[model samples]
Target: MPRERVIFLVDVQSFFASIEKTADRSLQHKPIVVAGDPERRSGVILAACPLAKQWGIETAEALWEAQQKCPGVTVVKPHMQKYIEISVQLTAIMESFSDLVEPYSIDEQFIDLTPTLHLFGGSPYQAARLLQHKIQQEIGVYARIGIGPNKVLAKMACDNFAKKNKEGIAHISYDTLPATLWPLPVRSLFGVGSRMSRHLERMGIRTIGQLAQTPVERLRKKWGINGERLWLTANGIDESPVSPRSHDEQKAIGHHMTLPRDYETLEQIKVILLELSEEVGRRARRKGYVGDTVSVGVRGARFDLPTGFHRQTKLTEKTNDGLDVFKAAFDLFCTHWDGEPIRSAGVALSGLEPDHCRQLSLFNFETTLKKERLSKAVDHIKNKYGAAAILRAASLTAAGQARDRAQKIGGHYK
Candidate 1:
């Protein structure tokens, strides 16, 4: 018989806000939130501490709404670089407990402790407690841990039970699913959100147990492989491994920006599109990859109605040149745009291959070689000085966002 797998999904409580509290002891007990600059049109709550949560402040809510809820809420601008550094440090700490550690996100990670459980305390709970304590002691932040036989149950355990339980540790298994997880609403399942829960409820599967009891064939016929996967997850069956290199595999490189105001003209929209294309190209080059597919996405300024288009086109040859990407992206935009006042635009490159594998252009061989060398030189200068060190003439235009974006990470101040 095979040994039951012991997996843990560890989540840092109010990661960004907690880090802010830890860095400033004066705000340790005060209601606080990490938010973007109000002047930049990114004035939304990114993370809120427990005290803030008590005031009904939530992530993704407008900062003004949070302020209305709690007049004295201490708002701290996000330090993305600091958060990333601490996340890396946290990952290093988890690696000490087990070799099979995978980062699910900046604030969540999965660790398979099947083999190391005995080394820690000979029991799953004992090991989890120790790990939790170590994180608090070293990082000055609280962690909620969910233990299970697989990743899905572990994630659900953390989100549904551990975070709410007093001890901040919860365990779930196939044996416990009927008694513990099945009684909850179907929406509480890891993969089931509001939209999916509605679909399941319409099928008379209002609880996880109901979903688990429904025929897999019925779900498979409806949602194809996804429905079957949901059913398996409801049954607490997940065979995925915790691999450390999960994020190293890149499928695409993309960048998106929400404009300060609506851009109504094609020229203005194209300016932002070109800036996005440059960023996409720079990132791809930094990673030593080239791509053949360019995608353009645009969203309208109207919030009351749905509006936007995401389209992609394949080039004859893969290239990481900014101008090349912009040409393709611009063509796509011109072909599909509906002439709405745009609020945001994005550019992406996919169908990736290593730069070394790129075939020389048959017609523009010399020009291509020169462009590649020039791009490398520019990349080198930017890396040594800063991202804003070298810029295209278009980036100096009022419509360009590259300058402002260079000062940010993930659309927030670094």
Candidate 2:
């Protein structure tokens, strides 16, 4: 008989908030929230502890609203470096259980234990309980694990059932699909978002059981290939491999910043664009790649009527130099900008190629050489001294947040 494929999806509950509680024992059994910036009461909540959930506190809502929900709730800021270190440790632990481990996010991971169960007491459920216990003992946080025959089922079980149970573990298989999975609302399915659920409801499919029974032809006629994928998923069918290397391949390197204050002027916006471009260039060079396309994204400052702009430009000569990327991104921004007050902006470099190989352009030969040399010097200084060692003249202006960002990991405080 073929080996049964057993996948485990594990999630760290209220990750940032839980980390805060772990860091300080006083926060235990209290309603706590993680906010981007407490002073900005309008800032979005990143995470809310289980106690906070009782008052209907939610992530991505304004902190002020969360305060309204629970007047006594405590708000904490994120510590990205600590979270990242813990995530590294968690990944190491998961790899001990199975070599086929993939980190879906900092707080979520998937591990396939089908072929490796014999190494760990010959039971996947036993392994999950052991793993969850280990995380609690080592990291001082709660973790829930869901076991299933595939990634989708594992994730669904983790989110829908395991997360709510006291034991923090749940299992689902082809055998229990009807009893455990089908009765849930169709929106509870992994691929079905709110908008998709509304559309499915229009077609008289309110539950996963209904969706599974609906004709594949009917769904495909409405949604094309996506409908086929959903039909398979609703029926507990997924054939995708649990490949570990899938996340390592890079399609783009980008950096974005949420400005402390709205950037209303051209000079202010231009400075941030240059800073983001430099960061993107440094990362691409570190990865030993050059890119031919540069893209820019701008989010408007209007809170109620939120809108953003995105545009990209292709370069004749591929380069990873910071100045080169800034020039391209700046041009795109100037061309496509609606001149609206901006709340956030980002720069991305894509269509990557190995930095070691390059084709020269006849039109701008000496200019490109100078830019490459200058960018190399900047990267060298920053890497040796610190990211703050080298900053453009524009960054010295009042609009600059470069100095603040240098001390952060992923734009959150260290």
Candidate 3:
């Protein structure tokens, strides 16, 4: 027998900006925006409040463009710690509702109410309302939740309908699936990114209904396993479990930075790569793993043309040393680079393995040992005092952004 699932997806609206308003009461009624890179007023807007959004201001736009849209829109720096603290509080609230709560991200979650609805007077709607009201009163952030027979429907309902509704909630099931889900664009389905959407578009599959009705054999012939999977998703037939363990999977560890300005010289570009290498090495060392491959990507500064270069090389041995990562990235850049102005640069270490085993070469053993010692000492100093407590001479130069980046989390205000 198939049991009906009761899944609810909760999304906090403009999370960062809402937290800014809640922390500072005066900003609640104003046009609030949370942005990064305070040194550049033209820096990216991470979040925008409802009022600012009304004026066509949006997240990811330049702050200067936002000000132009809503003239004098209030700008605030992002507080990652404060947001994380509040997310933890929200998690606690969801756990109170049901033991099957799964946190999807910083501002999203899924709660299964199938087994726990009896405790809430046998009404999932009532439980949902209670959670919404309590969060507003306690946390002062508005949340919209979508209810469905499974996770996929719940997510789509929340994104397509619930967030825009007056009640901030929507419920979907077998009876309502056809009218609600079938009419949406095929591209609107989850897991369908830009590339997939264009491929489906070329095949004349424009809407979910068309996709669901297409023959299984035809879809399989077109996309192999992925095509069949898309067909199942379109039909609202998902058998996958909502496992929380998925978050633990780390395939690659890397960091990328959009420069304050373009880098036209090789010396300037390599300096940025070294800074990124340090952070990547620190992260890998913290996790006690080393990568078998190193990759580098450089994005062009010219927005109109929008071109870049990428290269990856296999390492003779896995490494977590800062200097090794830098050298690998530098060699890639030297080999593949065309000397174009670079707007961003990134370094990644992948094909991870535990550091417990060792395979050493007699020739390079001494040099490798020295680099490892230096990396550990630098990591210790930064962890104890601060990331900016010590800096390489190259980072102190005009080309380096390590000082400004040290205080940031994922290239945004900390």
Model 1: per-residue lDDT, tens digit, 98-145?
A: 989999999999999998888998898999999999999999999999
Native-to-model Cα distance after best TM-score fit, residue 380 in candidate 2, in Å: 5.5
Question: lDDT by residue for model 2 over 170-211, one digit each (tens)?
Answer: 998988988999999999999899999999998899999999
Q: For residue 377, what is the lDDT in candidate 1?
A: 95
Q: Rate the local accuracy (lDDT) of all candidates.
A: 0.92, 0.89, 0.87
TM-score of every model?
0.87, 0.87, 0.79
lDDT of 3 by residue, 1-414 (tens): 576888889999999999999899999799989888667544789899999999999889888888898887888988887898899899888888887877799999888888888887776678888889888988999999998888888898898889888999998786788899889888888778889888888889898888889898999998899999998888888765665556546688899998989999999998999999988899999888888899999999998987798889998989988778899999999998887899999999998876677676789989988888888899899999889989889999999899988887776666
Candidate 1: regions farther than 4 A off: 115-119, 194-207, 214-227, 262-270, 299-310, 331-342, 361-369
Off by over 4 Å in 3: 35-45, 56-69, 80-85, 88-105, 112-123, 179-230, 261-267, 300-308, 337-342, 354-377
RMSD of candidate 1 to the true fold? 3.1
On the 0 to 100 scale, the lDDT of residue 61 in model 2 is 91
Q: Work out how many backbone clashes candidate 1 has.
A: 0
Tell me model 2's lDDT, rounded to 2 decimals.
0.89
| Steric clashes per prediction | 0, 0, 0
Point out where model 2 deviates above 4 Å. Answer: 40-42, 260-269, 297-309, 334-344, 354-385, 409-411
Best by lDDT: 1
